[model samples]
Target: MNLNIMGPLAVNELISMDTNLLLAFFIGVGSGFVLESCGFSSSRKLVGVFYGYDTVVLKVFFTGAITAMLGLLFFSLFGWIDLNLVYVNELFLWSTLIGGVVMGAGFITGGFCPGTSFCGAAIGKKDAMVFIIGLFIGVAIFMAGILCGRDYTRPHS
Candidate 1:
């Protein structure tokens, strides 16, 4: 397989925009399939993590993180990827902490993370469907706030 050594394949124009999108679509589908197969589409599996009954979700995520780290390392070693070209988002302390708390509450109550919610919805799970709807509503509200020039992270002073 050919690889781009300069930078991100799509970002550096090594691949066409259409190809990039197509690749992303396939990867998303594959990931969803894997999640469902691992029973991640079921909210019970994730909720078990919090209750100390099941730890598969936690294990899977930890494994994923380690796998990604090693993959990036190997890719860089082979000149297939350029670490310098990678973009990392800026860290916001308060927002990040608040978001984590909110997301944790959602996961405990709703039983699905953003990605697993979609995976569950794909299989016609009603609760997952509702979660997705609520997710979209939340996104719309957040976007509206942003469009209206409301900085949620700041005080009203």
Candidate 2:
């Protein structure tokens, strides 16, 4: 018997778009529930990893990463997935460095990562709501700056 399971069901044409979207919605909800249950919705709990007061976040992050890597490796070995078909972002060193610095600054000053901010805000945390608002404002400002920069650099035609 021939069997093929080389990748995502969506890619394999085994799942309809509506079903995929519904599954994604449910998965997102489940993930949020898990995150809230694991105390990730709390800003203090998240920051505790940085302060050495709690390392659960770090441990959980690493465990998840390692598990994903191992699963991918095993799946490839078993011919269940095609590694070459995976989409990986092209590296831009300077942009990556700048983005990392900005993200780190936000994490330190805001006391909540983006994911936690959403989770916290979902649970009605005022600070998280403010952080999310600030994030949107920042994005707006950044877009404005980009638009201005583009116009300034455009050739007079």
Candidates' TM-scores? 0.89, 0.86
lDDT scores in order: 0.86, 0.83
Each model's total of backbone clashes: 0, 0
| Candidate 1 structure quality by residue, lDDT tens digits, 1-157 | 6633565788878989999999999998888888998988899987998889999998899998899899988988988778888887667777778878998888888999889999889998899999999999988988899899987765422
lDDT of 2 by residue, 1-157 (tens): 5466567666677788999899999989987987899888888988898899987789878887899899999988888877777766666666667778888999989988878899999999999999999899977877797877753222321
Candidate maximizing lDDT? 1
Span of ten consecutive residues with least summed lDDT in model 2: 148-157
Clashing pairs in 2: none
- Which candidate tops TM-score? 1
In candidate 1, residue 105 scores what lDDT?
88
